[model samples]
Target: MSAFSLSQALAWIKAAAQSIDANAAHLSELDAAIGDGDHGANMARGMAAVTKKIDSAPPADLAALFKSVGMTLLSSVGGASGPLYGGFFLELGKQSAGKTELDAAGLAAVLGAGLGDIRRRGKAEPGDKTMVDALIPAIDALAAASDLAQGTAKAAETARAAATATAPMLARKGRASYLGERSIGHQDPGANSVALLFAALAQACA
Candidate 1:
């Protein structure tokens, strides 16, 4: 088994924050095409809070780390994303309670649980022009891998492609859904952000 440490998980959160900050403008631009333009600002702010909270508190275990990330994002971010992402992490924490190390399958289980929370809360399906478009395929790729390194790397790649693929899809959920036909030809910001998250996880494992 390839053991993943708590420090690696912590690194993933920090990298995610940086990725959000770096892509904030891009995210908002994508949102503006089909929904409200505040997605980037809200995500950046929430991720900053997540970074600050983790840096100062330094969670002792995987569950605590996931909880800190979940609670911080829930309170700090605005709009639908806060609850979705926050609930994702909260569920991840719950599933991973008392765990400190992860093999490929172990990591997949926690991440799968987190994605389940997002789907349950948002009710988005594949090809819905939502984060589910990116997340579902990415997790599937991960689940098919033989090791943590390969899984994460493949997941990240799948997520990016899935996010890009959302551009041609008609929005069927969230604020973007209200745009109807006009939502076509625009990428889903939530999907892109989810891609960024997988990228961060891949980076952490690297």
Candidate 2:
């Protein structure tokens, strides 16, 4: 558990798929309040693709495996979430190149890179009601945690907290922003998904 492996990463993807599937209706409900009403379905389809790819032929290393997931999700899923989350995982694969197991510092760096990719791709800043708010704080918490398990749990908690905090904030990015002030009082779909991502990681790592 000190370092993540391809199998472990695949396990995370599977867990994330299950989480997304389980929450699909809720995610759709949340998106209907602010978006096109496809966040849940899109994420579920994307993760299902990733799980299928891994089941067919698991990659040899972490980088290849995660990259495969990224590409699969990007192709199989549509909407803003596909490219944003796809880029996040692609950046993670790049950051984790040549490593099977990552230490605490390595985890921080990979998550940082992933967050940067999300920000750049989405052109989002904190408080924009985008995934960046959750991802950035989750990474910060993971960086500060003492161990991998603790770090992942902290990351999940941070994501959940950030998503909740978004309820009162006006959306400034993505489809949610089109709602103007009406966006307030709704949890961002992306932020909720970010929470699911970290929670899946925690489950896999545990």
User: In candidate 2, what are the lDDT values of residues 111-182, reduced to their tens digit?
Assistant: 899888888888998899888888888889989976888888888888899988888889999889999999
Counting clashing residue pairs in each candidate, in order, gives 0, 0
Candidate of highest TM-score: 1
**Candidate 1 lDDT trough over 10 residues, lowest sum:** 1-10
TM-score of each: 0.98, 0.97
Off by more than 4 A, model 1: none
Q: Which runs of model 2 end up more than 4 angstroms from their true locations?
A: none
lDDT of 1 by residue, 4-53 (tens): 67888998999999999999999999999899899999999999999989
Candidate 1 TM-score versus the reference: 0.98
